[model samples]
Target: MKHFLIIAHKAHTADDFSLNDLPGSAGRMDILCRCVNSALFLSHDLRRDVQIHLLLLGEPDPGRVIKFDGETVRYLNPDERSSGSLIKKALDKDSSDFEIRSTPGVTVRDANLSTLLSEFKQQGCSLYYLLEDGKEIREETLPRGDMVFILGDHNGVTEEEEAEIEKAGAIKLNIGPISLHSDHCITILHNELDRREKEY
Candidate 1:
């Protein structure tokens, strides 16, 4: 499976944020919504082997992880507003360390990046940190097994967070020299993976 973990550094963690203004009131949640769409959507259907996790660290409350499993997800559209609505519903529910399902194939939980990384490690997922200064992704042999890519939203991941991820054994990779939006990066990564798969 392909896993994407996006660090939404300033995305609002509460449902009270206005969906109508996801870019402002939701604290740049629109970026995350677009990431979700890019991660799972295809020309006519969703990618069943993909899952996207949004790590929200914003005001009022923080450290909420929203996961969308494309295998069984329903009611997810290609539009940003529709994805935002699903995210809002997940935030409305009470969350604990245990995941609570807000919609089909979507779950919410109270967890931090470190804990999630540990879990992914335990699951034998090959972790890759996406950054512009890192090694070019095409230079490495992409793993055929379960793999997870870590990326950040507009503001990008902080130095401390990058340290933690590297300490957890995530390999740093870059698509190109120029920095791109997190959502755009995902789309490019997916295309690369698709081409690789077709070659095999």
Candidate 2:
């Protein structure tokens, strides 16, 4: 399975924003929402092989992880309303590794990059950090095994966070010369993988 982790440094842990205006002109819930949409749906349908992890590093709680398992996820529509509701509910709760049977596909946990990377490493996932100046992404750069792609929000990953990722041995990768939004990056990566997979 392919994994994507997007970090929202200033995303609120509680649902206290306007759905009509998620960007809040200053907050990042908008970006997170878009990221969720990208991770969950493709061609207006669920992707059975992808797993998206939203690392919420915002107020009330940091190191909070919201996971979307496409294989078992249900009741998800190809609209922001569906995704927005799920995101709001997940953020409003205060727990570690909370699971909802009704929404079995989505899992929320109190986790950080270190813990997540460690778990993926144990599972034998090739970790790659997306950066603007990193090595270009190509078929040769991608691993034949399971892979995990990490990205940052609008503010991008901080120096401290970058250091932590480096410690975890994540190879730096760049998709293009120009920087793109988190969701756009996800789409590009998935497209590249899908195209390459079909070629082979």
Candidate 3:
């Protein structure tokens, strides 16, 4: 399975934001929504082997993780607005340390980057930290088992977060030398993976 963990540094943690202003009132949630779409959507269907996790750290509350499992997900569309709606619903539900299902194939829980990374490590997931200055992705061998790709929203991953990821033994990788949006990066990564799969 393929997993994506996006750190939405300022994404709203509550369902109080206006959908009309996802980029503003919702704390740049539009970016996260787009990332979700890019991670799981294909031409006529979803990628069943993919899962995307959004780490919301905005006002009212923070440290909430929203996970979308493409294998059993329903009602998910390619549009950003629809994705945002699903995310808002997840945020509205009460979640604890344990994951709470807000919708089919969608779960919410209270978790931070460190805890989530530890969990992934325990699951034997090969973690990759997407960075601009890291080694080229094409030069590295991709893992056949479960893999997790860590990325950040508009603000990008902070220095402290980068240090934590490195300490967790995540290999740093770069899609290219040019910087790109988080959602765009996911699309590019998916394309690369798909090409490799075809070759295999």
TM-score of 2: 0.91
Candidate 1: tens digits of C-alpha lDDT, residues 118-148: 9999999999999888888887899899999
Across residues 39-70, which tens digit of lDDT does each residue of candidate 2 receive? 76878678898898888888777778888888
Clashes of 2: 0
Top lDDT prediction, candidate number: 1
The TM-score values for the models, in the order shown, are: 0.98, 0.91, 0.98
Residue 189 error, candidate 2, Å: 0.4
- What's model 1's lDDT at 121? 98
Q: After superposition, how far is residue 64 of candidate 3 from its true place, in Å?
A: 0.3
Sliding window of 10 residues with minimal summed lDDT for model 1: 131-140
Better by lDDT, candidate 3 or 2: 3
Which runs of model 2 end up more than 4 angstroms from their true locations?
A: 97-102
Tens digit per residue, CA lDDT, model 3, 1-200: 99999999899999998889999999999999999999999999899999999999998888999999999889999988899999999999986999999999999999999999999999999999999888899988998899999999888989999899999999989998789999999999998999889998
